[model samples]
Target: MTTITLGRYLWERVYQIGVRTIFGVPGDFNLQPLDYIYHVDNLRWVGNQNELNAAYAADGYARIKGVPGVLVTTHGVGELSALNGVAGALSE
Candidate 1:
């Protein structure tokens, strides 16, 4: 059996979906998990100042690139802050 970290698995899935650019804000809980970016080919992470902005950027990227947008954020308040932007992305 083959074993892989969730971070690596997540990135591999994202890469499979044609996500070359990721937009998000790294938080305490997500920092380590996001390190899997380095192991993927042509996958680059774009750090934002906050979750809200990250969500918006991801939404924008998804629209422009015609692929899924990946967003990373911490728990609680950080997740909540991105609600509006994510909702917008879903609506459009």
Candidate 2:
């Protein structure tokens, strides 16, 4: 029997959807998941200065690539910091 990890499963889905790059800030909480991302075939990780900037980068990538963009961030403050950028993406 083969065991598939949650991280691997998530990345597989992301890659299946045509997301070649993922943007985010690395955090203790996200380190394990990032490790999985590193091993995924054809998926690249783009580290950003902050969660807000990561969100903006994902939005721009989505606009240019015509595919849905993805951002990964830690819980609490990381998620909070990304709210403004997400709101901007939604409004524009």
Candidate 3:
């Protein structure tokens, strides 16, 4: 089998698992993985204005698509900002 970096491995796995669309706000820490994921065929990365919106969007996508939605964000504030939407999703 061809060798792949950890990022590529994750990207491929997500694709294999039928995750055709991902939503997130890009930042330095996560840019590499996002780039790799976006490059993969049949996979699309949906850009959001912020993490909270991304998480909410992902949740909506999951409900309609019957698959887990994913969101990537910057560390610290980015993650914190998503908590509200995440909580709402979890509570629903």
Candidate 4:
């Protein structure tokens, strides 16, 4: 059996659902996973200035494209910053 990283599993699941664009803010924690995740797939990475912006963009993309938009961020603070946009997306 082959081992698959969390990143690869996420990429595969999203890709299967027609999610080709990933919006994110790369940080030390997430950069490595970003590199490992997307390289194996034909996915486009859309870097944003901040985690909140990335989340908003991903949400918008999801609405426009009819597919789930992925937002990648680091743990704790980074993920917290995106909650507003994520919550908004969920409310709509």
* Model 3: worst 10 consecutive residues (lDDT sum): 31-40
Model 1 misplaced stretches (Cα beyond 4 Å) = none
TM-score of each: 0.90, 0.93, 0.92, 0.84
Candidate 2 Cα errors over 4 Å, as ranges: none
Residue 43 error, candidate 2, Å: 0.3
Listed per candidate, the RMSD to the true structure in angstroms reads 1.3, 1.1, 1.1, 1.8
Q: What are the per-residue Cα lDDT tens digits for candidate 3 across 1-92?
A: 87888887887888887778989998888888887885678889889999999999999998998888888888778798898888999998
Top candidate when judged by TM-score against the true structure: 2
What would the per-residue lDDT of candidate 4 be over residues 1-92, giving only the tens digit for each residue?
89888878878887889988999888888777788665556888889999899999999999999998789888768788899889989997
Name the regions of candidate 3 deviating beyond 4 angstroms: none
The most accurate candidate by lDDT is: 2
TM-score preference between candidates 2 and 3, better one: 2
Local distance difference test values of all predictions, in order: 0.88, 0.92, 0.86, 0.85
Model 1 scores a C-alpha lDDT of 0.88
Residue 76 CA displacement from its true place in model 1, Å: 3.0
In angstroms, how far off is 48's CA in candidate 1?
0.3
lDDT of 2 by residue, 1-92 (tens): 99899999999999999999999988888899899987788899999999999999999999999898899888778788898889999998
